[model samples]
Target: MEIVQVLHMNGGSGDTSYATNSILQKQVITKAKPVVIGSISDLYTTNPSPCLRVADLGCSSGPNTLLVITEIIEAIDEICHQLNHNTPEFQVFLNDLPSNDFNAIFKTLPAFYEQLRKEKGEKFGPCSIMGIPGSFYERLFPTATIDFLHSSYSLQWLSQVPPMVEINKGNIYLARMSPPSVLQAYTDQFRKDFSLFLRLRSNEITPTGRMVLTLLGKKSEGPFGKECYFWELLSKSLNDLVSEGLIEEAKVDSFNLPFYMPSRKEVEAIVCGEGSFYLDGLEIFDINWDGSDDDDNKKFKFDRFISGQKVAKLIRAVTEPLIAYHFGDAVIDVLFNRYMEYVSDHLSKEEGKFVNFVISLKRK
Candidate 1:
């Protein structure tokens, strides 16, 4: 699959759109808020700029996109307010692949600006928001231009599907039963992709600039731990459809998502190997698959339909395009419907969780 062309969150604000189904991502942003604030605080303290250049890399279109930018701006404003300095002008760039829905983000800008004006009054410094369509794995900005860079729940996506995926003919991603070779292929791809990401950003960011990244990750040493089961379950749902002749088995074989959940060790190793950035901070948070909304309910009657539907919507928002391209749009709904059922059944038995990694880095 051509990831650049086909891989994108469901566009526009509809029921199945990523805009509506991104609570999990929002939770990730919330979890990383402290790190984001700290990074922004340090950015201004060490290298104060009257006009700060910020880029939200892999910033898919949605409310969360603006939420990130707003948080950064607010943090800067708070810092300047405490330090008795004037607020800085912001040149904010929203970045994602060319296929992302830039129009959706544009439509919401009016409301965003209105909100900012109301909150900050006349003290709100000049802020410019524009969309830049490109992959962060490559050079997206000119040398030493960006002041601070942020990406959330995005770097987990590999630039492209691994070339040696033929080793795991029956599966879509790394599964518990997947051989060591399959895991190695994913590890190698992530190392290559992340090393390139650091090198590119190292060139674009000022020597004192900072970057904060929040990505889906694994807590255990192996890949077959938390946050990795969702794909495994998704593959099972597709296998069921293949048995029922709803989709061809060969189609499933030919499909693999351009995604990987790296362990914290792997992230640190790559950062060191690249030798372009200093790892300032690294943290791993355990997030429930449903963003921890259902954690308090244990004795309550489990509503299979609602729980299944919720998880299904979240998964579909992110993976619909990829699945539809391979299985045809006709089976899209049917496939997700079955996936919901499977997810509901699994959640009923045990709590589902994702290991999320939030890292803070500085250009060398």
Candidate 2:
């Protein structure tokens, strides 16, 4: 499958659209806020450029897209106020694949600009926002043009599915049941893609520039871990359809996700081997599948069915395009319904959590 052409969140503002179902992503960004603020503040205070150029790579459309930019601008504004420095103009670039909902983001610009004017006053950042469409694995900007960079919940997506991953039959991603060859194929692909990513960004960002990246990661050092459980449930759901004769078994066998959740060790090795950036800070944290469920009160009544539906919607919004492209649209509703059931059963047995890695880097 052509990932660049087909890979995009469900667009528009409808119920199943990414714009509406992205609270999980929004929670991730909020959790990583301090890292983002520190990175932006440090970069600007150290360099003090008159016009700061920033890019949000893999910035899929919706409120979350601008949410990152607003946070960065506000951080910079606060630092400038404290330092008695004039607020610098901003050149913000929101980048994602060509198929992403750039129009959805574009339509919100007027209100965003108005909000900035009202909050920061007239003299505040004439921040110019533009949409750049392409793959981050390839160079998207000129040399030394960007001063700061940010990407959240995006890098786990490989540039393309590994060529040999068809061997990973029955399961979509790296699962405990996958063969050793499938595991190696996935690991090799992630190393290649991530190394190229760092190299490309090293070229685009200034020497003094810094980057803050957050993505799904795994707690274990091995290829298969708890992180694979999410995809496994989806696979089971598809297999249930297969049992019902809705989808062909061979189709499930051939299908594999273009995603890999790296371990912290894997990430550090790639950054060190790439030889371009200094890893200033790296952290691994856990978030529940239901973004809104933060409390640990045992006395509180937790509705597993409701939480399962919520999680299913979030995954469906992100993966429906790819699934539809692969298996046709007829299977979407049934597939997710079964998926919700599986997830709900799993939650009833035990809570599920996603591991996330947030890293701060500077060009060496």
Candidate 3:
């Protein structure tokens, strides 16, 4: 499948849309706020520009779309206030695949601008936001033009599915049952894609510019871990449909996600090998599959059914476009219903969590 054409989160503001189902992503951005603030503050203090050019890569539409931007702007404003400097005019670029819901983001801009004006008063931003449609795997901006770059919950998506993963039959992603060759294919693909990403961004960012990236990652040195259990459950849900004759086994075999969760060791190796950026900081954290769950509350009870529904909706919003494109729309409801049940049962047995890596980079 052509990932550039096919890959995008579910668009619009409907119930099933990513706009409505992205609380998990919001939580992720919130968790990474300190790192983001620190990076932006450092970038602005060291090299204050009259016009600040910022690009948010893989910026899928939703409340989270502007969350990072808002933080960056606020950080800069705070610095300007403390230093008694003029607030730089902001030029913000929101980037995603051509298929993303740019219109949804566009519709919300007026309110975003108005809120900025009200909060910061008249002499503030004069910020301008625009949508850039294409893949970040390729260059998106002129050389040494961007002052700051940020991405969240997006880099794990590979440019395309690795070749010869047909051997990864009965699974949509890396799993315990996957063969050795399948694992190697995924590892090699991530290394290649991530290395290229660093090279491209290094060209676009100034020498002193900073980047903060957050994406799914694994704690183990090896690829196979509890992280694969999430995809394994989804694969089982599809197999359940195959058993009932609702989906073709061949179709399931042919389908594999264009995604890979890299380990911190792998990420560091690639960043070093790419030879374009200095790895300033790297952090790993975990979030429950159900975004709303309060992990800190000792008295909190685990509700399998509710957690199952929440996870199913979250996955569905992100994957439905691709799944519907490949399997036809008729199977969406049935597939997710089975997925919900499987996730619910799995949660009852064991709580599942997503491992995330947030890294800070600077151009060499």
The whole-model lDDT of each prediction reads 0.88, 0.92, 0.91
Tens-digit lDDT string for candidate 1 (1-364): 6789998999999999999999889988988999999999988988888999999998998879888888888899998899899999999999999999999999998888888889988777988899999888888899999999999989999999877735575689988777788788888999999999999999999888999999988878866885677888889989998999888888888777789998889999999999989999999887767664554555576676676787899999999999888888999888888889889888888878888889999888
Rate residue 359 of model 3 by lDDT. 98
Per model, how many backbone clashes are there? 0, 0, 0
TM-score of each: 0.96, 0.98, 0.98
Q: Number of the top candidate by lDDT?
A: 2
Can you give the lDDT of residue 12 in candidate 2? 94
Q: How do the residues 1-364 of candidate 3 rate in per-residue lDDT, one tens digit apiece?
A: 8899989999988989998999999988999999999989988998899999999999999888999999999889999999999899999999999999999899999999999999999999689999999899999999999989999988999999998734788999988888889889999989999999999999999888999999999898876889768889899999998999999999999899999999888999999999898999998889889786464434676678988999999999999989999999999999999999999999889879998899999888
Predicted candidate 2 versus true structure: per-residue lDDT over 1-364, tens digit per residue: 9999999999998988999999989999999999999888888888899999999999998889999899988999999899998899999999999999898889999999998999999989689999999999999999999999999989999999988934777888878788988888989999999999999999999999999999999998866787779899999999898999999999998888999899999999999999999999998888889786567435678889988998999999999999999999999999999999999999999879999999999999
RMSD of each: 1.6, 1.1, 1.1
Which structure is stronger by TM-score: 1 or 2?
A: 2
